[model samples]
Target: MGSNGSDPPRPVVGITAYGEHARYGVWDNESVLLPRTYPDVVIAAGGVPVLLPPVPESAAAVDRLDAVVLAGGPDVGPDRYGAAPHPRTGAPRPDRDGAELAVLHRALERGIPVLGVCRGAQILNVALGGTLVQHVPDVVGHSGHNPSPGVFGTVEVALEPGSRVGAALGPVATVRCHHHQALDRLADGLVVTGRAADGLVEAVERSGAPWVVGVQWHPEEVATDVRLMTALVRAAAQNRTTAP
Candidate 1:
């Protein structure tokens, strides 16, 4: 049924998009793009999805948003965390790195709810003085977390009871993942809330924020579950209602 006139406005949630070379119809060119799943999940969770392209001033757009989702993409530039790029690390996208880092900081400064998925989780860590594993197989001795390109692997994550991620996803979740890097040396004020059996950090959240969760898995790829996104939207709704 449609909402009555008394219903509140849907919260606007911004999802970051990356610039990439692509082809469509008769033209092949660089494009600002994001997977459709990100917006679809946000909409399913009762939030309006807005795509934020990687631009120097994109951070300013956060001022008009109720929440933000740092969508998954390329590996965060190793230099962002004071490290040399691993031989396995993909080439860096400076524009994307700068834009996302700025956007994340602004969102936190304003106390906006944020969800970081896959590469987004890595971005969250690096944005807050943390480092990354660089290559997961080197540490875990297996490629299960990221079996192959364009293919998502399923990994079980154990959530910490009472944590925001756990509250939304329960104690254990079989999540979709597709990344070779994971959080390491967590930034101050960020707590690990979920982990894989191999002890890789799978999720983290800001200690004092109302909602700043980052998951190493790709929740958007898990079409059957919308709990994580729903939690973010609900938090955004609450933020909208309580903002001064």
Candidate 2:
């Protein structure tokens, strides 16, 4: 898992990307967008990082990767979980919702490790037949989940003593966060592995063969806790060897 010549072939990780109106150079046009830090951290963790733009074909691409990083983006459409949009919800992105859902379905079926960050976490919950709080301020009584605009708020997170996240990053830690929503009705098989100081569901995982987890904070933002990403690459390597 090293970048050196003697290292074994690294696990290939396909990271999800979104389409947005972006500004670069002197041009302002709609374009595919992905934070470079996500892939940079993946490479630093000894994985081959590939940015997967939002497209229907993402389902097929999911098959070729050993792991998937569902990057943070817009709010998932409320209709995905049979709820009406919250007054605080941003504009819908049903097209993107469909694309990532397909990736999640295929990754789970193929036993590929998945790390869902921020918006990715919400999407994970929805993909597994769960719902989101839609507006954390409404549920938690404040903007603790997202303290400010364009800034990563710090929050203390307590991990379940025997949970996968706990094993990866210890029992208690601080994480960088920037989100307005959190998990509500968890999927049946999914277990809450961590919580914020305000009791928001900050982390979750399905206890089984395939490594699957969703974190409400942005570890990639501060590059502070790379254990989750590292764990995924490690699992991906193991999956590669055992893959037929």
Candidate 3:
């Protein structure tokens, strides 16, 4: 992805890749994978999408990204929040957990723009000492948030006026959602910027920070909602120009 004559370089957006077991081509295999829509949406938003596998050099790799997407995946282990695992909690992956946390910490320290989606948003809260409602349906009175295993359901969210997410999007939006967890206690310095009809926190933004945001719904899941990614890319490009 590029610009017309003399335009600035597109921001390099790094998206986290999760490891999974798969069968493809000639063999059953262990693979690093990301949904095509994630990167495709990024490119359409005028950014360079780079897949970032969990690695020992993750923090350093984060240093190189102009922006980062903490892609959705398995649950954050209860240990990170110092609690016993809830019955519905997904099995833990220390590798994915460790790698993304390192990248997040480094990115925050450097003030790089960051977007956290679904599990990404959960971990962003966890990373900042907030807790999560392990099984959202148990609290919300419906399994509609995640109608089935690996399925997305539609829901409406109301955005806070004058908030980052509200400003990027409008006062309300119907979005694609697929998750069993969401933010519990508010993280320090992170403000709730959106909420679902059931009143669960749907979005958060860090005040006084350079473009840090988290959304409980998957904006990448739908091609039409590229505003979030575009906002992130714009912030990233601005950060690049202002960086010393």
Candidate 4:
């Protein structure tokens, strides 16, 4: 990990949006009340927390953010990665997909640091020409991965020695997650940094970037898991100056 110079005094980080299912039309609700305790996590890490709306005007959104976060949400569209929908695939939201793709593209093009969680991780894969398992049970031959359909379950992740993820969370660790899909083909330029006990991919990262890590877990829910947020914020602060 290389440092540009003395770190900037402060930086602003943006968390991606998640749509709401209101009674009327999709009310386009915003996450002002703080999602998954991420606001406190960012503030504790010495950064400002900004809730990013699902507005796809890349330049406008990307310009104001020193770093961007892709938070966990609904499943990514299977068609985005050249596959048919799975029997167990959840509702697909094309609007959210398009908006996030634009945000991701703008961030990557500007060399901004990004941290993806759960569905955000899948989105990272699809954005780079990769595919997903649709439903882990159908492929992994087990139902433990998605234990209770919509509940968090513990999984052991095998981390590659000397990988960025390993350095962040240690050699091997257990993480809590709730998902039905897993990565099938890794995105180009992305290396699998961790995997579940059932041999499913758990985390990935770019080879030489400051911080391009994505995990299949909701680290924000575990406030004690400070490493996840620390690593992300540190990398974002680094990119603010060294971004190319």
Clash totals for all candidate models = 0, 0, 0, 0
lDDT of 2 at 28: 98
Clashes (candidate 4): 0
Best by lDDT: 1
Best by TM-score: 1
C-alpha-based local distance difference test score of model 2 = 0.89
lDDT of 4 by residue, 147-214 (tens): 88557888889998888779888888888888888899998989998988778999998877657888
lDDT of 1 by residue, 62-94 (tens): 999999999999899999999999999999999
Candidate 3 residue runs with Cα over 4 Å from true position: none
Off by over 4 Å in 2: 4-6
Residue 160 miss distance in model 1 (angstroms): 0.5
* lDDT score, candidate 1, position 82: 96
Candidate 4 regions with alpha-carbon error over 4 angstroms: 1-8, 23-34
**What is the C-alpha lDDT profile of model 2 across 115-159, one tens digit per residue?**
999998888999999999888888889886688888778899999
Ordered list by lDDT, greatest first? 1, 3, 2, 4
Cα lDDT over the full model 1: 0.92
Let me know the TM-score candidate 1 reaches against the reference structure: 0.98
List model 3 lDDT by residue over 129-235, tens digit each.
99889899889999878999778989999999898888889999898899898899878979999999899999998987699999999999879779989999988
